[model samples]
Target: MNYSKKIFCQPLLWVIALFLISSGCQPKTEEQATAENRETDTESKLEPLTTENVVEVLTSYEKEHADSLVLISTRHGDIKLRLYSETPLHRANFVRLTKAGFYDQGEFYRVVKGFAVQGGDSDTRTMKNGAYKIPQEFNPKYIHKRGALAMARYGDERNPEKESSSHNFYIVQGEPKTVQELRAFEAKHNMKYTPQQIKLYTTIGGEPSLDQEYTVFGEVIEGMDVVDKISEEQVDGQNWPHTIVPHKIKTINQ
Candidate 1:
């Protein structure tokens, strides 16, 4: 064999061997390829909810995630809530966002003493406004009592249809409404108060004026004290708390 040819062939063999070894190191196993395919499929399937598809998407989402119970944990205390199935769209939207890590990124930013504690739209969060809105799922039975969970929305001047905010929400820490006050609200809003509503407004107390104005989707079942504490936080001119109350919202079942 010619020494020149032998030398050249030796280096070429080594280079080919090295290339094969490097390529073989990253062997894509069957399980690994399957997992990657599944991940890609899931990502492709999840589309954004828009005004045209919000109702349809949420209606489908509701069937799978019938989760109603959610827990909001803050440094002050944990607020346990029971989402109402009556408001399916609102409940499903909330559950979806909670799973998508939406509320985990925000805080109880707006605290209005004796009125409500607004959250799920903190300045710290990136989702300043929702991409889509849920239709007003106003159930007359759901009054804005203390600890009642309701969706926040823009004013009627701009939003005549009264669509609910997809992310922002408030828990009522309302003061007691006198019978005279309830009557005044009914007359002004053309609303009628039931015996149970009047009793709750007078006794346990709530923002009676908010009845039917916003969609009440849930209620604080176990942590009214925490709700009260959050509401009483010292706030600024914009109702944002001086010391922000960061929160992590989670579904109890999920």
Candidate 2:
């Protein structure tokens, strides 16, 4: 036997046998492989958000995203909103969407004069129906005063838990209510009005009926005028504006 040929052939056989063993020994299921890929590749794909993962994802997102102010630009004017830090989930979600350009060129689709200027139903980037709904972050300190920024939600009939919509929001253009009116509302709704709510509703004018029903997460630090203009836009009987009130939301100081 030739010793050189034997050595080379032995090494080649070992290399081929090792390759087969390595490939066959480790078995990964589809889910395991996908999970590993998602873990390794964090830059490209986001984990699919569901009821189970929403909290974890948002919690992780909140640590990095510290944006507390957003600007909604429109033809009418720019509406600057100061997001409340108390409502961390809502604040973080808004910041995330704004950073993702989810509200770009969106219309104030529903403008109920003297009530609110509801938007975030952008023609381009509207969240699909049955999307993630956030838990209610109701604080007695926050009320539906004029220019109050709040999340819209389904009625208590379906949304008894009062979860807020993921994207749809409104800026109140509340019609002033009197002390007596507020008292009546309190009696009818079985909700007590806070001193702060009473004072703001009486002085600045706001829809007191919305108190405790919706999550007021922020307020208009500037551009109430723009909100007023949007609310006054002409609408058909369905509350939809005849013309589009396009808007773009951007995160600032993130």
Candidate 3:
């Protein structure tokens, strides 16, 4: 497989594993993956947050919604996104972070061309600001189409509920697929997408297998080329950009 196709396939494999996790299919020990991730992210005892704290924050922001367009200013270019009103919890968290300048100067640390460019954690800023989880806000109205803005979270072993991370997010740069390709995914992964979703995957393109697994709360309204460019940038062994590609996000009056 070529580089872009290879990158796209890796995530689908993970999604398949997630599907299995839901249906009593065991692929890898969730314990191993969770342990590795924990080692990668050393515990920070400072300003630790609780579920109650997160719930309280969610309650206080019930009325908060994205009335203005949000722009993620990146080194490649600005990516304008429209947060979906249907997914209020995820939308509110994104809007709150953008307004607070939490994403400013953050680098797109993980970039996989034709897959995603992930950011929202610049030097552990979320932890310093008191990080918390948001309940899964999966809406059928949203799918992982190219330019889709979605939150990233832990693997199924640790996050069985599919809870989303409070800060980290990604923009999809997925490629279009044929009906045959999608059917193979359905058979291998033991999941299915709606006919409309399948149509979207075969046309405009997206990681269709990720539809219900991740929280896709928004989509790029402009500068999709920039997101694509970021995905294609040179990266290190870890898929992190060779050089910093910073993202500065803010709320703009429409």
The number of the candidate with the highest TM-score is 1
Cα deviation of 47, candidate 1, in Å: 4.2
Instruction: Summing lDDT over every window of 10 consecutive residues in candidate 2, give the lowest-scoring window.
Output: 1-10
Candidate 1 structure quality by residue, lDDT tens digits, 1-254: 11111100111111232222222112223344334435444433234455678899899999999999999999989999999999999999999888887788777765667777777754344432224668999888899888899888755654578787667788888878899999998897787889988999999998877777788999999998998888778865445578878999999973
Report the C-alpha lDDT of model 3 over 36-107, residue by residue, as the tens digit. Answer: 345444343333334457666655674855454798887788889898878878887777766666677366
Candidate 1's TM-score reads: 0.78
Query: Over the stretch 78-184, how does candidate 2's per-residue lDDT look in tens digits?
Result: 99899988988888888877776657735687677777777876444323222356788998788889999988765455568887776678888877788999999
Residues forming the 10-long window of minimal summed lDDT in candidate 3: 1-10
Cα misplacement distance, residue 252 of candidate 1 (Å): 0.9
Candidate lDDT values, in order = 0.72, 0.69, 0.68
The regions of model 1 sitting more than 4 angstroms off are: 1-47, 126-130
* Model 3 root mean square deviation, Cα atoms: 7.4
Candidate 3 achieves a global lDDT of 0.68
RMSD of each: 21.4, 20.9, 7.4
Backbone clashes under 3 angstroms, per model: 0, 0, 0
